[model samples]
Target: MFLWRALRSEGFPFVKKILLFALPTRLGGALGVQVILAALAPPGQAMLAEDFHRVLLSRALPAAVDGPDAAPAPEPLPSPGVPPTRLDELRKHVSKSALGMEIGPFHRPICPKREGFNCLTVDILPRDQLLQAYAEDKDVIPFQEHIEEVDVLLSSGLFASVAAYTQGQEARVQKAEGSLSYLISSHNFEHLPDPIAFLDDAATLLADGGFLTMAIPVGSRCFDCFRPLSTTGQLIDAHTSGRVKTTLGAIFDQSASAATHSGGQTIGDRNYDVAQVAVDACGGMIDESSFGALQFTHEFGHSGGIHSFVFNPYSFLLIIEDLQACGFLPLLRVQEVIDRPGQEFIVHIVKISEASRSPLPLDAARRTELLRQAIAYYIDDLNATRQLQNSP
Candidate 1:
């Protein structure tokens, strides 16, 4: 102990400063210096404070080797319920997964709430308009490589913007067949320069097995003439049928409807009924025999402030059956009906493949299930809209 104390006293070369500044007293300073020096200068060489004694004697040094006993490993994450190989199913799964991730950590995805309207909202909107937007914005995902041309992008007057776009692509003409691609102008189909003749030309222009997609309103009839009135307006009266009344009111404000008929094609006191006109505008480019697939999207409320109407989901189903009866088969699939946040639609996607087959036979039970889901989806969406509306 005496030798240890002596050696420790010599450790820090600055003993006087340590005593004056660090320790406050000469004796205590010397004591600290001796202690530190004793701890550091080999175990036996010790002096001064108890702090120094503990430092030298402690055996807390870490070892490099792992001990024989170790905690068990954690379990792995489970595999996804869905298989990722099928394109349609895979797309659905990926979209759902990506959407789930976008929400904040605390919230889980609840079924989308419905807005007050006629039809359950669809995932796809303003179908042709949306397509054109994607095309104009360079946002389309070209699934097949070397698309010589888009087969046929059929449309109604609503897609007039797309028609003008096709006309502008004249440079790609010759093989372009651009005009054939723009078989639009549904409201004015009857007045087209040579309506029948134009359609004939379009038919001759389309290649075999080409696909034509259009977004035309589907219902008992299409009232072309404007009936410009708010849904709650007074011009609507006792004698007018709800369908015609809504059509006339929503499509036109009094001034626009008053304009002279552009030909027989003008929306007058006449009615263009059902979706057949949109299909018919294709000339023979598409018919029951060549009809590929049909997707019906319904939205109750729209930009024009039309009163909401129930989407006849049954009507669409009937159409599908009619197509099959007409010889086209393989309805193959039906998507989970969705109700968008503020719109009304039950959009259907029908893919026609020679080898395609319907997932299950259409029957009472299935139809009931579809109706239940659609209504439930809309109810939820309506609640959501109310919440959003009430929110500050």
Candidate 2:
């Protein structure tokens, strides 16, 4: 080894590097062990040349054999995206426990004015449903034309004129202190060219975190149903102007015009599908998982079926599912069915919040299952409707 080292250092440039590694490694096992020992344990009187030879030999180790730090702990693989686990986190936060409030007016569809129930009674049409409920009290506040004043308004041939008047009244009440809720007409949306802009204005009018309740026809379920020219005209104008942001429940048969004079584009026939509208308009602004069935037909002395998407539980379930998909936290507490005295149903109630994710307690598998079930239900319901239409 000493002779080999001397030859290596004495200007043997051609064989220097190769001999340094091969000589030590290729030595017989006994010599290899000896060389290793000598390199690891420098003698007290070790020569400078010996030390230099040992230092030069150490760097021949492979990178795989190097220290952990030297190899670079593989840069931690980056995240794929917002993980599924994170979406579940949002769901937990979206649960009912997240909200704090009593859901409905004490006597819904009953004039809150009479019982002084600190809640708003929402109606989609000029119906005296609530007024009649509290007529004994005569505490009616004639802010706008409800069904109580529908006859009067109709007699004046000024039904459309009352929409603006009601919007103003709702705006005023929304601004008032202790205003529990705001009522709106479904027709008002059909009347306005831009429902979103109108809703934004209403949101502004509301108390911060206050309630907003309104119904809309989901899609073009009505076929050749006659509606007033003004009503259809408003919708057409909106469509032409590009203000129609939703197609969930728009009238598809608007061309038939047979129903135009009679409000042909009305949402009826147990298929007035507006799931998409609820999602687009209310999902972001409200909690969708909180929705269920508000199934009471106590108002209007009959089923307050006006604007009801369908007259059954399944219809509501589909709607709630849509709301959930749209990221709203839904809370369905009431289940009153119209014209069905013995049957109980839940009302769909969702709260608006600052959060954008779902608050329901569901895993990814369960959520996907829910989506599947909803789609299946839609297919069945649509097929059933078609069968009914074609039946003798």
Candidate 3:
């Protein structure tokens, strides 16, 4: 009974075939007949059971492997999320419904129709003058001419009143205040002799919930790479003294460090020729002696219109905080700062009322440290992006 059960359970078809064929041929007589009968008791039933077992085993054990103990392979892991590019990150922060004004949008306005931002673009030059300049050199325009149809709003007329920075709190307020929700100044802050005053005026121009979005070039990354970072103290002194002209020291530093590039291109794209230009502008070898006899004649030609202020992200934040501490009216609060790969960093500031201005929350040292950390993170991300692009 046990033998019969084992044969049936194991589906031993080969054993049955051997018993039926070999025994009948080798042992011819009663013994061979008895052996065949035992192997396949009910011959028709044995044949049917063998066929069914063969089909069932073939379908049940489908996998091909060395043994039952072998483990199955693991599935592949998912890819990591790609980090956002500098421009992509910047675009995410841009407001859509905000009614704002962009300054010095020569041709390519930062806030365009495609962005759905209700922004009015104004340049230092009038509409006709800007068009004439564009005709001479198309390269002067950075991106698309989104601001071509925008009316020519002069910088001087944008404010209600104009006074020197030294005049204090009164000059910070505007005469013709608008109901603007925001203000944008791209690559325009460095050109101003007094950035604090400009910022103060901008704050005054904005409505209660308004903000100012600005992009300023970092000295270490732009054409001003060779120039020393402007200190907060120097900016404070310049504003207090009410100096409109660029200092002799500033001019010398700029000329000495001025980067040279081929043809007409933005300052950001230019390569710095620090070695040659530094020696020439600084008189022989570059040293403190070069600035000793330098006079402020305001005769530096076209270079005069270049950067009046040079800063890195750290220094810029320092200056902004210091200005706030100096009791500049209308209170401009730093909302966001984005460090870009090229030459500039973008800062977004909101205007708060005088009542809200008192008891400033930010500690300058801690804030500066935080900004430095943020800048480092941005640099790492940018480097990683470049490495990924250059891979293979």
Candidate 4:
């Protein structure tokens, strides 16, 4: 029984073929008679015959009967009620938690009925000018309400005043140092001609462990998507050279690719159309004639006041990391990045001055490598999402 099972398990046809061809002629008749007896056995005890029949039906018989061109059986459909697993890992990374309890004076109850914490809100215009602008536009009323609650409203336009508070300004730095627990800027970093200086100033003002929370527009979803991603090198150059105008290339790209959110749709959906008028008026080759005419308009003409930089999340994080390594933004750790549904991302950064060790500077080559890796990762994530959506 064991020998029969082994032969059958090892594929009987090959063994049978070898035996039939290799057996001595004298023993051939004996083997053939045994095979006949096995085949003629009673059905109840005919296990070897049953096994042989099954092998023939499962292997050689089907192909012989159906021919070589038969189609394969259809695959089973995925079971219903089984949740899609594609985005589970991604959603975990993007989900928000309630603001951390350890955020020092900036801890929530961000808006208090009566002021309890010392906070500084930085803006280009002073309080009265901001109010006047608000008065002209009813849409600004909501912002005005929040501005009214601020303890100190600092104007960046007053260069001398800001210089007083920033590091290296001995007299003013001492007075303001570690005094402010919270500093909030909204939609302002992109307007700064020198973001490094602004960051240094904020770091100088913030108390040890204080929080700096800011909301910045995601460049790809904004009008600036047409513009190229700005690099730390570009920022360093602007800071060092005192360039007052956004490059002409940036201006032309912005104008040429200006887009607005489509009706009843979010920017994430890529439901947008070009603003043709903007292109007609502002987009053109920067030849001598056109350069002279368009030079002082749109982004370049506005004293670099338009979105001076463009960033997606990866690029933005890379800039922040490089800035910290360069010592332009020391001891600042990014605590959280919260994605807003249709608009911008909010970043919470904490100044961790308690640590005894200082941060090391990241070299230019390493910074570039890190930025490249981040961009590649983001691209891979986007490609994966697209592939998942297209799969059957």
Candidate 5:
């Protein structure tokens, strides 16, 4: 070992770097050691080429006191792209101590009961029935083991699913400051006809600073590739018109616009090639024989079985920003929007800031800029998906 040199603190300014290393004070693996390393050259000699700083963590490191940061004002022009943080990914973000609700968690519950997660599930079918429905398929057989018990069952529609949860309205109101710390869904948010109203209801169920995590399919990358991106105007119209059931137009669009999922679809952890039927721009999806029945039934009747909305990351953010800006989603603000690489994207929208009931309009220029960026992103995403599928 080189002989240790004791340097004066005043020489630090002229020195090249300060290195901190932790070595045992004694040769025998004992833990109490705090150290600082300094390499200094003589006045006439050239400075040693070294790293500016290097710190190695060892025994007795200082503990950190974590605290929350002050909430910032809402963004006027929300970006089309908001990346993700793996540190606070879906599973990690779900608090074990607090209650969480997962909607339509058929077989694969994100946080299973065996994993010690405090999660309650809501679905249209119970565990056994869901198992029966999806059991015959060899593909979903492996995940059948993880099927959780349905905590909340919605038979008719999802518009009142939150309010219709267990323990009645009186009890919910008593704890209405927020009943759940987190609410999650997988590929289900787009199914609701009145997504805005569902979000408003979600606001009622979610506590302050709670999170809503959703893993939704990207229209550009999935079977919905041919569908038009759900616009702010369409969403606003749906919300203001009080759509309780799926509209006939929405049903027609869902069937007619769905392209083959074979292109670049991902199933179980990036597995592909589910649907092999090649089609020309989603043509012949709705047969003439089925159109009359579909139209007659879904015109003004109960038709909540199809995807009422289609989205990509940019379009999603645009809608979320518009909703928040206009006070439609008064309690929720977008926390982060990230893609899961191929077929879908995951978003963590948090109810951190509560706004007034009144709408807060954004400037015309800002709104136009956001829309322009979103359209560009949509085109780029679709083009990239096509390129990827065509690649060798």
Candidate 6:
């Protein structure tokens, strides 16, 4: 660790934070000296912390390796008679022999590098910056070692404040389409803007019969209890309308509807409805940073990091079925669902060839009845637990 006594002078706080963030980069490489020199820009021309941080990221990290070599994860891997009881157990089902591409594995990779599992890790930031991002909150990872190596820095160009970059041209720089054996993510599916687009993209990355195992936050069981469940129309509109980045409506709703679930124990802010607060403000004026409010005047990328979509497992299944029926996501099929009541649900989806395709009912009445039944899954689970807890 280079002591930045020369650069860490008293007056400039940005310098200190920038230098601290820069410390963990590939500082042993050729650009090591340049980073310090860059951080120490000419007197009046200092860059903002994020700008300087981006410059550091623009420097090369390790090249993304080709995906792991393995056979496809077993076709229709038998669902455990007893489902996994904890969120971490979601990783237990991922085939160690399978080559996997995992998304947004920020610090908690399902198939960690240390474990010797074959994975192509994709995220908004590389490993070192990921560590710096979580430096202040040490408890978030428990140990620094949990942060795994990021392989492919893929961004849907959604988060502009933090753009993902890599050294080479954006091609299949590491692996080819339909090359992966399986895909995995934990607690990431709900944050997507156009989930169908994402699923379609994921389908392209996997070989036929390859699986995508994802853990979705349960809307009713979590802080989103009062928020509206994601719909097939909303999911489709985001993709079809090309509002694939976080939408303005999403920003407004997030600012207006987000709740404090206090770790799924009690609804914290249900009484303090912010839509009323927005109305009480001047001219339907909500906060400027809100995606639906003033942020549109800025850029598309900064408008993200909002959970633009929300879902319970059942609602997700219903939407996936509808999307498939509509031929939106033609190749992906929902296979296994295991719910941990009051927490999240892990769904294992597999990619199949056209021969395996089946249409889900698209009739309005049939869809409504099915969706209502799906929504009831969460409501029933919530009421049953609440009634048991309240019983004398």
Q: Give one digit per residue, the lDDT tens place, for model 1 in 228-287.
A: 111111212211222222343222222122223223442221122121122222223434
- The deviation in Å at residue 190 for candidate 3 is 1.3
Over 4 Å off in model 2, which ranges? 1-191, 218-221, 224-379, 386-392
> What's model 6's lDDT at 297?
29
- Give candidate 4 regions above 4 Å deviation: 1-117, 141-174, 243-253, 261-294, 297-305, 361-392
* TM-score of each candidate structure, all chains considered together: 0.24, 0.29, 0.58, 0.54, 0.68, 0.65
Q: Against the unseen true structure, what C-alpha lDDT does each candidate score?
A: 0.26, 0.30, 0.53, 0.47, 0.59, 0.57
Q: Candidate 3's residue-wise lDDT over 1-392, tens digit each?
A: 22233355556655554553454432122221223445554654345343322221111211222343221221221222222354443333346676566777666666765567676556556666667756757576554354444433453534533222113453223333635667777788887777766776787677654667778887655667546667677777877887666676667766566764333344462233323222235545556565554552445433335578886655676566666566654366665454544677777666665445464445655565535533543343233334433456
Q: Tens digit of lDDT per residue, candidate 6, span 98-174? A: 77767787766678867888776778778898888788885766767777777676555322211232234642234
Error of 2 at 45 (Å): 94
Candidate 5 lDDT over 1-392, as tens digits, reads 00012122213342322322233232222221111122222321222211111011101111221333122222332222222343235653587768887887776777777788788787877888888988788878988888898767776444355455644753323343368878887888888888887787677777666778888787766666667788888899998998778887887776666555554543322233323424332245456766876778776555545789988765787787787687677656565566455566677766653432335466665566556655655555544445444558
What lDDT score goes with residue 305 in model 1?
Answer: 29
Ranking by lDDT: 5, 6, 3, 4, 2, 1
lDDT of 1: 0.26
Per-residue lDDT of 322 in model 1: 36
Model 3 vs truth, CA RMSD:
28.0
Residue 337 of candidate 1: its Cα lDDT?
A: 24
Q: List the residue pairs that clash in candidate 3.
A: 160-175, 160-176
Per-residue lDDT of 377 in model 6: 56
Count of backbone clashes for each model?
A: 16, 54, 2, 0, 0, 1
Q: Which stretches of candidate 3 lie over 4 Å from their true place?
A: 1-97, 113-116, 141-152, 155-158, 161-178, 245-248, 261-304, 361-392
Q: For candidate 6, give the lDDT of residue 283.
A: 30
lDDT of 6 at 236: 80
lDDT of 3 at 24: 44
